[model samples]
Target chain A: MEQEKRPEEVKKTSARKWTESAKKVRGLVANMYLRAITEDKPVAWVMFTLCNELFVAMDVLPVYPENYAGLCATKRVGDPFIDRAEADGYSNVTCSYARIGLGYSALWRDTGEIPPFAPDGGMARPIMLVGSSLVCDTRYKWFQAFSRYLDVPYYAFDMPGPPAVTAHRPDVREQYMKYNLTQLHGLVSFMEERLGKKMDWDKLDEIVRRAEKSYRLWYDAYMMAGRAVPCPFPAEDSFRCFVPAFFMIGEQEALDFYQGLYDEIKYKVDNKIGSLPEERYRLLWGGGLPPWHTMGIFNYVEDRGALFVFQSVYLPLNPADIPDRITNPLERLVYSRYEMGIRRAEHDRKLGLFGACNFVGLGNPLLFVDEFKVDGVVMHWLRSCRGATIGQIYQKRLLAERSNLPVLFVESDMCDIRDYFEADWKMKFDAFLETLETRKRAGA
Target chain B: MYFAGVDIGSTMTKVVIMDEEVIASVIGPTGAEHRRLANRVMEEVLRQVNLPFDEISYVVATGYGRINVPFADRQITEITCHARGVYSLFPTVRTAIDIGGQDAKGIKISNGKVVGFVMNDKCAAGTGRFLEVIADALGVRLEEMGELSMNSRNRAKISSTCTIFAEQEVVSRISEGVSIEDILAGLHEAIASRVYRMAERLKIEPDVVLTGGVAKNIGVVKAMEEQIGFPLLIPQEPLLTGAIGAALLGKELTLKAVEGGKPVERGTRRLEEATFFE
Candidate 1:
């Protein structure tokens, strides 16, 4: 007779710890919705990519439908809205965020009241609409569709140009910056006239400065602190941490939140405290948004000793070098965004990794493989988001060529949980992990 | 020491009992009740060798219903098990494609270990179920499809990979007086091309192994070979590779434990029947 360990004892899963700032940010978001309904402040429906810090400076209640749609999905209240939108003749293949946003708005419009199950009492009705053409055309177009339901004044800025890869060309860069500057000036004028107030340049400058500091701290906490042997903060936390940065970038609370986050991460790195006790594998979330409905998938992967140490979304703004003579804060904002694009393009060109047309893909993720020292890559091939799904397959091939790392592409919609199948995902993950383990053993 | 492997797949459950060499094996359809079917199949395989359940030192379960096997010591994914089994049978095999009941997988192997894998479990368009559906629609036996396809003079084109759409297309072709053999041949070509494109993602290498219920179809194998540009090596018992690989893995684990001066971690060694409840 010989002693034997129990079958259950063979499995290993570590308990995870999330930052306090992430928890507090949820309450902060809830309050934004409440304040819009209660206060006399100008409530504006804004796009996520728009620099909403200007609204923060002006004391306007900026509501992000995109973020709210994500909230609806994560909170499990998104399905009805998605169904309603589809019933209203919105194509099933439309961007899910837009479908949900439009559906939720339609429900509110029909009843002249918040849908009973709407998250955080639903977003406050917009007094005005402000949008920018950035990231995807869907963002501004969703706002345009939204305006029809509410009969509100809508202002959209056209900031379209070449891909980020062409930003390095001086001729191309100046044209984009000049066009964006004109758009910003028009946006400011539109805001002043709509609100019946003059432009407060000093207040906007202070807000921009605060936003810069907050972003720097966010960069330190998210990127620099994550480079440890066992990462202290995982993608689950990063996904939540991005809220304050995106939703409340220029606010004092958002800045303080980052400070606390940075301190927590710094202490963890110093003490060698990792999200998992035994981190066997480090994975890069190569592309696409997290499936907000089933975030436990992150914990599931972590329990298998693989932590998602980096993601390709919600990267911090890297301001470009500008002459001291450039005093206008809006000019700096436009120039910084365009210049960052150019710099990234130039770096990708230097690596000789992509051609001119291949500007908007995971060239950065290929670089992150070496920088972050990941063992594998997992990409979510979203079903509904065609715009985001672009360049994902190409990126997977490029990753294989550049790093020889295994890439797993899981197909599912971010907001629509209907597309996900748990058993199928588990099998794929187990097989992928086995490959990683074998490669690790072989010292590949 | 005896080691047993149980595979609870969507369509069938297989069991293999081995000691140094294979001693017994059993294959049975997986019914609606997976746990019951798994237990019945395991018991039948054990009875063939006249061994009690406790006599088997280790058990490793694999397949779609792998987690449902309550008496197993470990559950490994069928992807790894298929690779290990295929590699054991064909040491030179670099790629293994397993088109099972509900899913299809492409496994990349290197020296008996899984290097990479791609799976198509999302849709029924590329699995054995697709062929089964079309075969049912054509009023033909599932097992007879390969021979029927081999008799075709001109393979009709199956434009739709979707099972529902393909079913409708097949019905239309039947009404148009096309021969059943041509329709069967076309279905094989469509599924073969879909699975080949999936396996090609791994940059498939030589000595490719084809396993699972679908591999028994000669038509599919021939069509796959045409697209892969290489002959596929299939096991003598295509359906039992996962169970065989599972048994081999259990043996390795048992030997490793014994070598380390430890007893094999055996749990739930009862030979009783199972139900959905405890």
Candidate 2:
């Protein structure tokens, strides 16, 4: 077969460009998509919330619809897909990622061919579709809908409740863990049966180790750069930095990418290089996925001299500590996932952080207001995606009650542009910056 | 020591020239090309005071087209401008609700400084534009809505979520032989309730000031007062408050710069009709 050409590059809407790791990941992801489309590798349609480490071990190239939806949005090609879905009776207020994903799938189903202009040559048709009852509520149903369109088998893994809930109920915790382990075993059997491939235990162990190292590097980079005086790694850059830990996890490339990121960030910190020329105000991206289409809003804020130092959404999951006694790779993988979830929950409980399914919200921004030295919190209140948006009002109230850190809720959708009004949003943002200036002057 | 402020809003452009007190002010419609209209409004205000452009010590721009005024020393958001403007008039004012052409915002102020604020979302509900759309559909003049609404004993209910739907509801009510006065009253009630609910987010305090083009509508002020459970203190010319505040802020900035032994950085005082070609 002839070499698959790389898709045309998407333009950067924001002033701050993606970090080096992100640029590399873009190529790697494009290659993965091309390879899967050409049937050069086994493919699995996956969601971001699931642990793709298993797919890595199985040698299946995992393609994420959520990531593709985000890309389409960033590339400004999401509107048609979203409009198509909405026209077909999908509620406009449902999860936009699901709408874009489903719409893309429908186009393929109807045409029996991938849309030529689809972002990243569109996602590869999977041998099996995967979902997780994790952070987002729309995953299982969305994947189920996709299975119907693609006529492929679908499977969903159930995540246990927050660690805070399980802390008090040991029996419930035991049952939940048992169920999760059974699901993992079932997933392995299902994969083996469907793909006619055996589990590579040693390869899985090596991958798990690599995933752990990548996660550690990601955590260290965020902690070091995130806490810097001027915040060398702003949220805009960190969003891209998340690609390695999120998509390429459990791979040697993931480890290399993060290491390079750590080195780059450390150098920036050491050289006193900041994301902005003058970071007058440090802010926390309060919660919810950003409006990918207008992500340049981050640059807009930065232009006003307010830098987003930390955000809870894209924070890396806590790396799991595997017991040395557990020699089996399967046991290690299951235990690692369970430990990551529980440990994160416990940490969040200690820090008074809000919990979201999957590992979305692990820490509270208010708790780190002093530590991060943030003067304000700007939360994107997505019209769709209720899972990320719930409790934001209460969180703002809590911020007011606990700290003087002002919270600005910028209401928009994660993918849909219709939910955003540029003039109204700019006015709101300008006013928010003024409030921050006034508060700073009054020494509040 | 003249300081001028130009406020280019979505539907109106206002300019205020002041020295210790307001000397001259101009209010005019903001046309399709607001940038050019902004210059004309500024020129008119300067003409009213019979002062050359160079005589004004500082010029500050505010409102939606705040940045478009090339001759202004600095541009401030309407939120801050409104708060400062209201606070200057009512020193004890703790909260200010400004419903403008396209958006309605509630500003929480303390000791002449803005502490917090909440504004309407992407929707035009409870905004001046919302009322205008409904009024257009009802074939009623914008200025007469307040008087007409007051005459209604039984007002019809209108949805506050979408302007188009609200207009449809108004049309349907009219088709049902409902009085236009009653429908106008309902529209006032809908907008009033929406703005009041938004202001409540800031924990509405007493001595609340209402400033904006919408405040001129007596019907809205009365409806707002009823919902807020407090009398709203409105300025003599509500539309000019942002411009007034901008001018005052410019004066303050200039004074502060001088007091700190620093140069007051300002743009060239070239007040001319603005052109897109520039």
Candidate 3:
């Protein structure tokens, strides 16, 4: 009772708990993003996950510079970014995200919004910058510049090549994986030292379990959409389903949230309450999420007696629930979840598309088409998404020849309302439908 | 007499059987495993109406997965199916935009048939996948994205032309503290711009019909309208327009086949049998 606890001891205890809390938060966030990546949950969910994780980790926020660049394009931000990057010797077409990010950085520097690292916000600076070498080589180089400029750590995750086309060449992937893992481990160790704490393996494991449960529950909800009446869960809401992915992946709270969601969805399914009006067609959707402004497609189809029964949102593999490898904790850390594997696989596929001189042919639309059994395909040709637009001709031809199915191609953006012309689309579609009827009558 | 249209899209298979008196339809996943699902959906539709499958006159199949439909009497390209579907739904439709999960097609129509079509089958940028990617990035539900987007007074521009890159871009924007509404607006505009390019290439005129999964997105519809400077005719059930057209065609064919007194083929008969119960 007479012995007073030293200030140092008190500080140590506080630091340990603080670091533990942070790890738990980061773990959950990581799990969500990892699941999104593994299951190809959606780009938005994945980004949210990443941002949350970075914030929890107390690291510099990882911004998707490309999104900002896109805004610039429509908002006239592109010109300044392009001009700035070019003036700095970056090419005009050097991955617009990089240009925009740099431009924003320059703007921030001028505005004093971003200051050098210190304990306070005004003085705090980024300690590290991370980039994935999945989409383009430009990001790799661009992040390098950031690393040098900020005088902070720069980490690049190398993605594998396509297994289908590359014949399973794992050298590049292995090298990248190893490098990324090494760097990640070092980062964690540095963080532990700075916080004067060791990682709590038990807590990490608990977080992972929560993430897995949440993912399963969300998946069950999506499955309910296949019922006759279907659930009101629109494919557009798929991103929101990943909320647990952004913040609670490895936490007990995340598990509880998902469990609750699962119960709600189960109740709906049990009640036979379809998401759309009771009608005849129970169509499945493939490809990416339908844009918000264009949600009318669901109502339009549903009104005509069709329901989106299934979708490719079910494609991602579940997170592995197996215990971490005691012998190689780093391996567990690197490949702890299946999302990373999925991301790597997708990244490789994108690389192949880029290499094939068809940078836009990144996603395999035919894969979803064949898997989902859609009666007719409505291919949304988004102007801003080159990756989804490259292989349309080939896919269409294949579908026509192989499936003898109807494919409707509509051109529009996911977010912008200005680019969609209802009158034009309606006239074309009406005639197209008429022809389908005629063909049916003619027995073509 | 009834007509039927069977559209086997990449994601799901659909069958529409329309009689002068009523219309019945069925949809299910399309795949090697879908033969049974298709049969079940068809059977269910017919069962609802207490109709016999044999009553259907003609059956036309369209879509990427159409060939897998064992019950279809004839197979037609999605282009033809959409053309027929659009024409039947809106006889005045001169142009059509059919956006599915995987591909996008812009067709010029005349007299209820496809005349000239410009399509993008190479990538998924302008397709539902693009929106899927963006929706995923924003952590918004696909269904709620449209509503949220509509709430946005400011539109954020998303420049990554590639789905993957655009996803990354979206992440960066969020981290930078850009409002989600702005990002959504930007994304919608990007999609519209792409479609506008295609329409320009196709020399699209007014009286356009917007069909497919993407047409359900109000933001995209409004964006397209703004970009093309024209009004759009959206069918009550835009996604099923192709299937509806196909069903109508099926009815016409069945009636013709019955009138001709030529015994319907086994495949046609099977489709009729499967779908007539409703």
Candidate 4:
């Protein structure tokens, strides 16, 4: 008989592993609301994924619905929440990450109780919900749907997409950056009025420094993956290390967590040890985010003697990417927006594809294929994600025609397990390995 | 040396035996139990070839029940097997569209290898089972519906991409006094359009072959030619292609064993190591 499928947990690694730090961050996330209820502190649910650093700088407790949704997806326990969102008439076509958030908020609002499965007793009720534009059309809209459920005021910021700063439209980059900075300032004003407090410029300067150090260390650790042989930390560990940068990006703990991870991966690469025991194949996980329920997929690959040396879904923020060193918190916030918009323009104007675009969409695997000594590229085409799933067929054709490497596209959903079949994926993965081997033997 | 491949599909189980030449083969409905049907079919094929099971050089099991074939020495995916099977039958075939029981695939082939491929997103609109449902609704036998549809003077249009909704539309057309022949022709056209779009996504090339149970349907084959705008090379026995591919893979593995001086275990990880989370 087949063994009963189980959910993946954090794998134990050396040096009082970063998972311990990540777990601490999760506890702090739960405490965000605990303190709100106990100490009467104000909490704002930030909808923009990257602005958590700003919220931390404001010294207010911050709750991230996207983070909570990811937590459920990673635990493989996102079913009920996803179903609830669907029940609320949030079409199945909506992003599963957003669906989990929508369903979870509705459950708390309708039942007036927290879900038993919510990580750390679930998210804290916020005084307001903040949103932003992203690669998907649904990111900001999903938050708007949740604001109605919680009866909270929703404030959204514009986050632009690819094809930025074209030569034909030089003013486009300036407009996009200016729009984001305006949104950030409005959010700060809204929070200050609601919390009955003033902004802390000195502490904000300290946070800017800490966040700078944190993002640099995170980028440095990931770059070690490009070494001839990468560090032995499991692929999921990369996702796990993302916790601090997401929650406490400006805190000393974020820097400490990243430095520890960087040192460990560096040691393994120097010693010629790899994440997998045999390490016969090196794969590049590009194109889409990992589906939380089927994370067993990684272990399944690891056991097959393949090491996923690089996954493109990791955060692309780097300290060097910051174009401005302004100490003023508001100016620094405005500069960060300019940096993001300009990076997209540079990516278009120059072939700076490796810089920032790796974090989202196809990101063009042109540079990654050989730089990582990639044996093959495995990309998932998710039904719920429009931008991520777009141009996958074109990506495969171009990769094959240019690099002469096989690109296997797995079809699955992000958080929804009903859309995934374990047996089907395993067989497909097995066949993919066979194709790589067959190509290798043929000297193709 | 003898090689055997068992393809345990959702609707049917097929076994192919390969020697210096094609030895023997067996096909049966998969029924309620894959294990029992797999064992029965393998034994029957060996009996037809007058060979003992132990004489087989290597065994490969494929399809949805690949893991359930406890007796097989190796388990492979039907995707690779389908490519291998079609390549062996029609080596010049550069692209293959296989409409299996539960799913449909558009595979790009070059040098007798799968270079690129696409499968219908988890849906029943363009599969063999979809035809079965329509045939059952029309009170026509699955095989005879092909000839019945060939007689239609006018093919009605089927726009719904969902099999359930399309079946409901067929029922309405029936009550509205639409001929069963016209309705069946429309169903064929609908499935062909659905599958043609998937093939076009891979960019259809010359010498394309159509395989699987649906290949037996002349109406679907014609609809495919009309829709795909390319001729398809239908194999002598479409259903046996995946099983034949499995046998060829088994043969390749056996050759590797001869060179390496050790048997190969196909499954790379123990179930516990694959527990993933812990």
Candidate 5:
């Protein structure tokens, strides 16, 4: 692992390692649920909060409904599930991810058998559910809705106020972190009671070390995108690259996959073999979820010789850089759980804000925009994820004014392609490219 | 020597041919054949100017069917086009409100290009279709509602967030003996309010110009003017602004290309402002 060979890895890896890592995660997810059904392994359904790695370390099979919806979407079979949820009275405005999951959950409740549309073995019935208030508050209600309908116990965890405050005092930061850490302890205790087993500290430590290594590998891999000229990857593949960071966090497979990916990407960079013929415009995807179903919309830009070097989706792999404030292995998991939000709240608090949701939605992408040498930006104004989309206009203006680069704001949905209009997006790209061309003409 | 712009809006298609001066313009309804309609507009403008299609140096297509336009040399967004067109018409214009048949937008412009903008293609309640639906409810012509609203004794209140529900509410109001004048006034007020809120999202500054087909409606225009707290500069041919802007962009693009190479890069030529949280 010579540091110098790193830049050459991009071309050597090509797109193979990325696809392989994602395929492995998809299989692992399928198998996790399969074992839960066949072997009766106790299943814990997970949400998009922090501490997912903690759940993986716990050895409980985690079933992610949100991730499952993405799979259904990728397979292009999500419409029925989404339509079924709408028919079940969850309105079309409810996120496609949540709608699809709810539809599947409702069908399971009605039939007591896997629906024909269910991917792989279908999500294993969870003995318990875990959720948190993060980027989308919809998850809080989405999970709560499932808990009530499925008749399963649900645990809601996180610090209050995004980093809770007791109203009058603004600086309850230390007390707040400890309280959140305590909540994680409560989750562990609940798991212990449910599984009827005591804690295993030594095994948890080993999992943390492996998970941290994989996470660092993921961070390093993304970092190479900026280091490599004419980024060997497309931002459309960001969701795929992040699959390991999401699912295989504690697995040796994630680390190895990322290491191979790193070497390949570096090889490409050294060979100067770019993903696009000539990456004239190195763009940064500022905010919004990648439309898993309709990523081909980017081919229009790719045709114009622009490459998206970094996406905000991959920005959450911040574990490699952040200093571990807590020495205890278990507590570090809790720290990772709430640290992002705490730092977010701290950033918000310093900037005169209160009761905010993950400002990583605002914070990290800006860092990447500069670090990636982004010549322009494309911000998706996702319709369903209101939390992320709410910052869209403000962030777009700020990015343009600050970066002094043309920004393209397009309306779309993360998992739902039905919400996308291909012509509208294409026209936007044409105009955006014109703006970039104008900037080029002005030599600005 | 010549550049053309085709704007295939949801309801109507507009074409503008320009270079140094506006040579010709055409307006027609946008039908199923977006490609056909785009070419029709191109032929219409070419016939008006007495020029062949190949004589056109470049073509920029805009609006909903922008990409669908078969003959477009390049497609541009209505947001940018509207800003550029409005700025060309009213150079001091800082904010442009475009209320089209399907989408309503508030674009903030600086230096004759869009800086920030918000568009409502999400719902029909905030667009020109809102008036169309209201007209259907009242059994009056779309153009008649404006004049009828101006004479309202007292405006009625309509509070439906959705277009269908609002239309239903209008029907019941008609049944309940509410005058059409009052209801029309209320409808204008309702749409103006929605558009105003969207404008506030972009934080409108003065020298505002109103573009798009809906700018032709005096009632909606007056209502929006009052709601936005400023008079608007309506274009001579309000619907033609996007097409005109596209043509202008096409001309500028042609000029830049003819200058031998890419646009000259000047100034500091370096930007390193990396403060993450602050």
Candidate 6:
């Protein structure tokens, strides 16, 4: 519980605590579903969204088979599950996440301890598997397979693509709005019949309000991190940030956590603490969290008096700093339910925006140079992230033609340190920085 | 009358105002905040010509962030915008290879319009982002990667397809004291190889207009040109091609509206008023 501990020590302690906390939360959430199943409550296991909410609202516990599967993959527990799923005719080329989720379920049914949260010796409650077809075809079919294997009810919320782009076309936004509402109604009815409790519209509304508020607050916090001198927060911390945001999404507790973080960020911004050192050139990094191997890149620029001002990390889920103002709480809840379900578009947009806007034609790197009045942009074309690479060529070209500002597109990887050639990076970076300085002198 | 095209791309948003041809263009960073940047860039572009926002005849938006643009009268996708832009620049361009920072797209063009386009948006292997990653790994700047790659005698083979895995591979190579130039050469080749695969999917033909930020990296261009077994025609300003196309589209649409005796929409009218002021 000591705060003044070495980072390694802190990491070790936090890892254990986080693991335990995750297990506890998982169990608490799981028990509600077990009770519903035993009592013959109509329940569902959703990958990410309304089926889970409906199950929870019905007093039925909802299981996130995907999260468990992710854990299995990262922890290397899903190999057997994957083999079993593939043996059961699941294609190996399917989304790793879906394959792993179904594989976990297959293994869980065989060895009951697959989840590590199910009771010592009892049949899990009758479950429903729910998913949307927005991300990939795997989840929709994976859940269907899971439902058949478990002999439980399975529901799919179909999400048709946005209405074809045309003038005077009927707005499919309304259809989407209606589709979500209809699904929620069905889920609520199923929960009511199973849990034997009348649906509490007011309680659901309150949860939605709190969740929206929390999302807004998170957005605000992320924005604050974009200040001229941002907080020294590492992007790898997204894992920690995602945990509470995903699980405790619509809860006051989650809002409180974000609010507290916001206050801390506000204090830092006010005090100008955690600001990158003053630099003659201000650069912006476009791409995902630069892997640890590339962390030195930041220092290299900073040492050269070049500050990396802002990045694309702010696009996806609004940083928890912004406030949400939803007039109709139920409508907002319904929106969140479906919006969360159709998460791929949002994810792709965010990742794409992060790179395209920052590294591409009108990306963050160029914006940072203008905003910070810096001299150049050092664009990292991360090899690992294909989404981030989409717009770099346009970015460099536009930056050069419009402002004639210098941009350096460095190709590198995040986690694979072995591939990095430090001497080459240094040589190129030094030359680019020199060019920026020379250009500044000539312009002056 | 002047038409303006704003491409709010994923990485950078470009603004190009053309009075028949380009008059002024500004490209800037796409930060966590876009609407603000859009407004700021528009102001800067207008200031260059002493024009008001209400004088522009048309405002067209294209690219990933196009929908988020509040002031745009019409929003077009990058696929359409790039095709139009490239075709306008090179009438005979049959194939367009737009290697942006994060994505590599190969488009087949017919009559200055995109017939079919293939894009690799999922991986960074062949795109500008891959080069950026390798540049960072090799401790080189974007501008210098081309020169460094050219200097290398040895070509190191980097086998990792994933950026995360590639970083590890680069670091281990550096630890082994491999020449930096060789490492860069290998990295550039890897990116070109990946892009070659995407280009192959589209069955790219000659007269390919290579547009986007990656075109600036001579190393990538050389490798891709060699891989494709043909030379590429790069525009004087390749990055602005998307915005240029968007602007040209805006102009065409506006002229069509006027010729058809239809009153311009309120948004178009405002832009026209802005152009008048300019």
* Chain A accuracy of model 4 expressed as TM-score: 0.86
Predicted candidate 6 versus true structure: per-residue lDDT over B1-278, tens digit per residue: 98899987657779999987899999887755753458778888999999988788888887766656667887766777888899999999999988886667777776775544556645567777787787787777988888878888888898976787888898999999989888887877888888788666556887988999888878778878888888989998788999999999899888888999997763532221112113
Ranking according to lDDT, highest score first: 1, 2, 4, 5, 6, 3
Model 6 alpha-carbon drift over 4 Å, by segment: A1-44, A50-56, A72-80, A87-89, A115-126, A160-172, A194-196, A275-329, A334-444, B1-278
Instruction: Compare candidates 3 and 6 on TM-score and give the better one.
Output: 3
List per-candidate RMSD values in Å.
6.3, 3.2, 19.9, 5.1, 9.2, 20.4
Clashing pairs in 2: A135-A357, A135-A358
Q: How well is each residue in A1-444 modelled by candidate 4, as lDDT tens digits? A: 001122345442111222233345445555645665566557787754566666776667777776777767766667778888888788887888899888888878877766656766677788888877755678778878878888988887665543533522547546655666677678778877776887776887778777777777787777675544644654556666676776667777678878877776777778876655566788887677677666667877777777676766654444445545555666665566456444544653464332333235344565467787888888888878877777667667667677877777787887776788767677778878877777777777
Off by over 4 Å in 1: A1-17, A355-361, B272-278
CAPRI class of candidate 2: medium
Q: Which candidate model has the greater lDDT, 1 or 6? A: 1
Interface RMSD of each: 1.1, 1.1, 9.2, 1.6, 2.9, 16.0
Q: List, residue by residue over A1-444, the lDDT tens digit for candidate 6.
A: 111111121111112111122234334334434564466544456666522334444455455665544444333344455556676787655544555556556655665443443222222444556676543455677788787667677767664444122111235455766776676667566556545679766666666667767777766765665543544332323333444455556655567767765676677678776544544765555544343333435566566666555454323343222226754554676555434323423333443432211112234444434544545555566553444455666666556555666556565543333335554465455545645554565662
Model 1 over residues A275-392: C-alpha lDDT tens digits? Answer: 7888899999888888877777888887788999878766654545566677788987776566655566666677775533222444767757888889999988888887667878
Model 3, position A116, has a per-residue lDDT of 24
The TM-score of chain B in candidate 2 is 0.96
Q: Which digits, one per residue and each the tens of the lDDT, describe model 3 over residues B114-228?
A: 6557766356788888998889778887777666778887788787667888888988999999889788878888887887787665668879889887888888888899998
**Against the true two-chain complex, what DockQ does each candidate achieve?**
0.72, 0.74, 0.07, 0.52, 0.24, 0.02
Candidate 3 at A98: error in angstroms?
Answer: 6.9
CAPRI level of candidate 5: acceptable
The predicted structure with the larger TM-score, 2 or 4, is: 2
Model 3 ranges off by over 4 Å? A1-107, A113-127, A135-154, A165-180, A186-202, A224-231, A246-248, A251-254, A280-285, A288-315, A318-330, A336-373, A414-444, B1-278
